[model samples]
Target chain A: MIKISDLRKGIPISNDPYGDLAKIFSMRKDELIKILNDMVNKGQIIKFRALLDHEKLGYRVSALIAMNMDDENIEKVINLAHITHFYVREKNEKFPYSYFAMAHFFNEDELKSFSKKLDEMHINYEILRTVKNLKNDVK
Target chain B: MDEVDRKILIYIQNEFPIDDRPYLKIAKDLGLDEFEVMNRIINLYNLGYIKKIIPKLSKSYIEKYERALVAIKANEKDIVKVSEFINSFENITHNYLRDHHYNIWFTISGKNFEEILKQIKIITEKLEIDDYIILRSVKSLKLDTEFEVKK
Candidate 1:
């Protein structure tokens, strides 16, 4: 049986320069398109994304920022630039912060200004800079 | 990575056309010829500006998998080995060497805790380091990484 996992086992897309999905999978183009169309319509495939590398795009100063703020402004917070992942931490007394977000900026000044803006808005937060990315594969 | 390219990136990142010629629709929407958009996407893919265009399954839809973040400690030299070992696991999605005592960080997903545990054991035992934290996500307020082209 052709399972969904089989679709993922093809050439690691990042490593492969040429996308020969039909040739690699040993399937005809029409059949592959049908499967893809069905997947998209069913919401199994969210979208065909072009995930830009923020660092490669000349943006620097990335951080894992933890913020403690009231619940009402959560909608306002997530719409900012370079914020890739935003989540509310599992309720734990020792966790220190309730919300976690990942942000990237062109420089330290920009990063600090964003943080300062959050602070001025009465949002208390802390951050940890990213030293290196080992693996950033989208799953 | 100019204006047209960024527009293409931003447009395609959120939604993909699922027709016989998907690029044709994108061209129509972006006010460009079909061939131009296709060529530009091919170029972007060739350049490492754009990663794979894959199926992004929803959490509720792909409920078989569960995810968590972990932090590990390592000195300068052994960090390479640590990252290699952690990323070797198919389920380990995002791994980073961060600026902290628990410097090495990564996210992993699996069918369940049992599957994740088997991979974790390899790291804990092989590295001979036990300082780590498993932070499970309670709720994802926002789970997108869209770039700004229009801005």
Candidate 2:
């Protein structure tokens, strides 16, 4: 199947990719529009988005942070600044962390400061610094 | 990145002109030559500021598939094996190694919650590491995001 992720890839939308999509499913044009519209209404589909190189644009200090919080308090923990790609994950016995986020900052000190505040609040956390984006492709 | 380049980047966020001469249209709007706009975009890509210009598909397109954020706690010996194992899954989109006890974090895409659990069961049994957590996006605060370039 030609996945939707493959469609939004910044390629020229030329022959090969489009041709590949055509090969996949057989559906009427009008039906696809209606089906896509229905999905969009239910929050099933975020219609459009852009993935930027924030580091190149000067938001260099970026990392994924996981915060330990109980089920009821996950939302409160994530009410921080500049946090995108946020999620409330399940908590386990071994690792109590239940929230995840991507933080982008222009300065490393700012990022350190944010982490320090979380620590001061007695919120256990882990900073998963991205060493290198090995495979960024969204399958 | 200079003013001209910044202008170019700003124009293409979430979309680009769809035409035979798309760059030409972009150049016209920015009051720069087509080649200049193309050159700056190319430069940005080479500098790693621009990953690639992708279509930015809708998340709903795969609404049928189940997805979750999974954190697997593997020991030092099994870290590499676990990472490789997570990468092997078909719909596992983004994978990462965090500096936490649950070092291996990856997203799993499946038909439903049961399918994800099945993948986890099979892998944990094979690798002999049973500790992990699964997090679903209960509410997507943000997705398909774009960054603003300072002038």
Candidate 3:
């Protein structure tokens, strides 16, 4: 059993209580950790991170960049993503069909310039500018 | 069970209250005496549920940007120094070290993006650490206040 202090000290895999509807219930401590650990071992929870309000902090520029890569060379793209200071990897849910990536810049011109770099590589991609944020993907 | 008590917690989470009779208005809405309402909140706070009672500010009030999640492989020896240094930033609103590669996660709200970037650059240079990651949130869902009690 973890004390209230322990629970508060270490991060709970998630702050969203029902974020994973199937896994989280009214469990606590060992029971909850046991379930989370089991899921982790099974590769259910691949990554976890905190989500914060950047715009509230005055970050007005953000975009979702979709890049089409040769399926054979996807690993190269993923490696590049890890090193890029601003790019994050995600699955493309919509068109113009390709692997999805997202990043934020200081302004529209910066975003465009960044996209231009990908264009130079001849990577097929689409840039989706974020106008408003409504829901956070809490993981 | 009254609406006033429920709303008060919501208000507390979103922002601190800033009025002489913050409870008075709540009391009027609930059709209860002002002192009684105030006493009830005081009791709840004493029970260790809330950290404090303060005023809430609008989003526009915050003005800084750049943020990053830095994980360090330090032992108990340097944890205090690391936390103190990060917490010293006046702009840092939320700081927590979660269990991950980038264990140290902080939310910084400054007057502008440059101010936020300035803070991050200073930390990176001082710490001489480079395995940090910045997971900027793309969206923010309105947080709910429901607490889950374990049986």
Candidate 4:
């Protein structure tokens, strides 16, 4: 079985995958191709993707919005284009919100608009602007 | 970004070809020169727009491991120290400081719930944190990280 650490090391964050992956894995082109294909076929690999920086792509603001709402209202939140990730989590007395979403906006105005829409829908939510990205390395 | 650049970004963000000559394939599909596609991608990477091109693992594949989003309410004075301590764990993939009562939020994954709880215990004990919550994901409504590039 392939170790997760080895897999992560073999595919470090870079734009140039053609040169980096093979060299890091120390495998021939054909051998590496077969391994990658096998992993994909086994459902271990989803798809190759380019992780873009939304901030550099004109998204100047990002926020984590936690919501306390029913399941019926989730589709409304999902319909919003700015929401990148949405999840339903176990809630408790201290953390009363069960739903969480991460959204990116072009500016604070966009966030305000989003908040207004949530208000119109009567969705109880708290928008927490991301202060700093401490770490985001692939696990 | 121009129209062509936007198109390239959209295509790659959705499905980057996993082939020996992925860029060449992208160029062919977009009816552009291979060199131009390669140059554009490299430029985007250099400008910090494209963080990386990586093989995303399947959700089901990773669901074997228990994962939870832990939120910690650390004092402003010790925020930096607390974050550094959390980042030291390889199991912790994402750590972010947000403007809220539970300021520090991070996602951690482990082989089981007990293992994850053990790690959290160590962190809480070391940092002497009393106010925190572990929000285990029950259902993921939408988890796509890709942002649609607009022209």
Candidate 5:
């Protein structure tokens, strides 16, 4: 069972102190390190990442762009290591959408410049934006 | 680390007492001394379990806007350049290279459709990304579960 102690330890220590389990449990520094390492090895801890408010940072525009892989086999396409955290979904050319994807930018000109590159590469894509955010992790 | 602390977090997650002596009310609910409850809260913060104790702002109550999650397929040879290009924009919030084919993922918020399209154009050009995908969130669900695994 996932214990409250686990919750205490799962508090990501990267940013918030209150999220640190060692401090909450008063564990020794070494013990804290061991616990974190063990959790990571067990796949209970996936990643330590930061979530920022881009709109607050001046990113006024953003969109989702789905693409269709021209190649039948995704070997060469998959080999393109630049793409990260992408998944394969059912392909749909008629819908003008493929697997899910995302992008963010500061201005229209900046976004347009990127589109030109897509055209040159012959990559098909579309853009979607949130009409409203029902819930987001504020803390 | 104990049940009391767990209760404190659960309570705070749902609602934080708005009274002058919020800690006292919290203590009453947990059957603990006011000072002890305050100490536990402080310790939780120090330990890194509780990121923040802030007001829950209802997104619906605020000015409504659209959001999108963009994924990019950049050549690994140009990953750094692509990341730099994406990060250069202040509007591109929460960009990361996760382990996948579409490695570069980011969340973007815009005022309107035009603004969203504009960004898409700029990022693809700047990064020289050949292929990409967009996952539009038709329905969103969020769960607040602290992950902890003990043997």
Candidate 6:
């Protein structure tokens, strides 16, 4: 089994994976490449990508929208550029929403416009605006 | 952030090279100096535009772990204490304070549902928060967080 902590420490998000990881893990460059290739082939590591800060990218507003809607209607919301995550969640008395979506907007006006669209579509939903992100460990 | 920076961000966010000299490859493709490209990336990080450039784990790999989106209803007074308490757990990947009745929302993952439940129990008892809901993700419709940066 691979030690995730060690691997994470070796290959940070901002550093050069090949050179930095090899140096940090005390492995040869070729060996590190082979290991990374193996991991990719095994479907462990999908692809390397950059995680952008949406707030700095002009997305000032982020909210979690919960709704009890049909799957067909999801297409409408999915087309929106603001939507980041859309998932079908388990429903209960405490949280009666079945469909959940995470959206980010450039400003409140954009959010209002999106909300207006939802209102026009007659989709009953509850908006849970994220006040603060206490912890977000994308490991 | 300018046109070149936007282009670089879009490319890196979508398809980051896996080669040894990845930044050099990016420089070649963009017709810029390797050091310039690297410096721009560093600048982006310093400006807080880019968080990290890491490998995205496959869905199958992630499916090995049990995960759930937990919503906790903590009083406004104890929000900070409760947030700090929940954030202390390594299993908790995401912890956020939302504007709702069930304010504190977080995603927790473990080896199994039992382990996740155990963690929840510990948190509830310790924080004195009995009002909470664990909303397990039934289906992931869209998980992409890539944003198209415009001029």
Report the number of the highest-DockQ candidate.
6
Provide per-model DockQ scores.
Answer: 0.49, 0.32, 0.02, 0.61, 0.03, 0.62
Ranking by DockQ: 6, 4, 1, 2, 5, 3
Can you tell me which runs of candidate 4 are displaced by over 4 Å? Answer: A1-16, A136-139
Model 5 misplacement above 4 A: A1-139, B54-63, B75-96, B139-151
Cα lDDT tens digits for candidate 1, A1-139: 2356655542233222123565566776577677776776776756555566677666778888878888776877888766878877554444467788888888888887788778777888878899888886543
lDDT of 3 by residue, A108-137 (tens): 676667666677667787655554332222
For candidate 5, the per-residue lDDT at A39 reads 52
lDDT of 3 by residue, B1-151 (tens): 2455555554444433222344566567657787776676565454444443221222222112333333343344565677678777655555544443444555565545566667777986787766564344332212222221111
Q: Which candidate wins on lDDT?
A: 4
Instruction: Give the CAPRI rating of model 3.
Output: incorrect
- Scored by lDDT, model 5 comes in at 0.53
* lDDT at residue B25 of model 6 (Cα atoms): 89
- DockQ, model 1, C-alpha based: 0.49
Candidate 6's C-alpha runs over 4 A off are A1-10, A13-16, A136-139
DockQ of 2: 0.32
Over B13-97, each residue of candidate 1 has an lDDT whose tens digit, in order, gives 7765555567788899999998888888778767767665644556565555666677777888998888988878777778888
Candidate 2: Cα lDDT at A31:
48
Model 5 lDDT, residue A111, Cα: 72
i-RMS for every candidate = 4.1, 4.9, 18.0, 2.8, 14.9, 2.6
lDDT, each prediction: 0.71, 0.64, 0.44, 0.82, 0.53, 0.80
Please write out the lDDT profile of model 2 over residues B19-38, one tens digit for every residue. Answer: 44556777898889987777
Model 4 collision count: 0
Query: For candidate 2 chain B, which ten residues in a row score worst on lDDT?
Result: B54-63
TM-score of 6: 0.91
* Alpha-carbon shift of residue A9 in model 4 (angstroms): 5.9
Q: Sort all candidates by lDDT, best to worst.
A: 4, 6, 1, 2, 5, 3
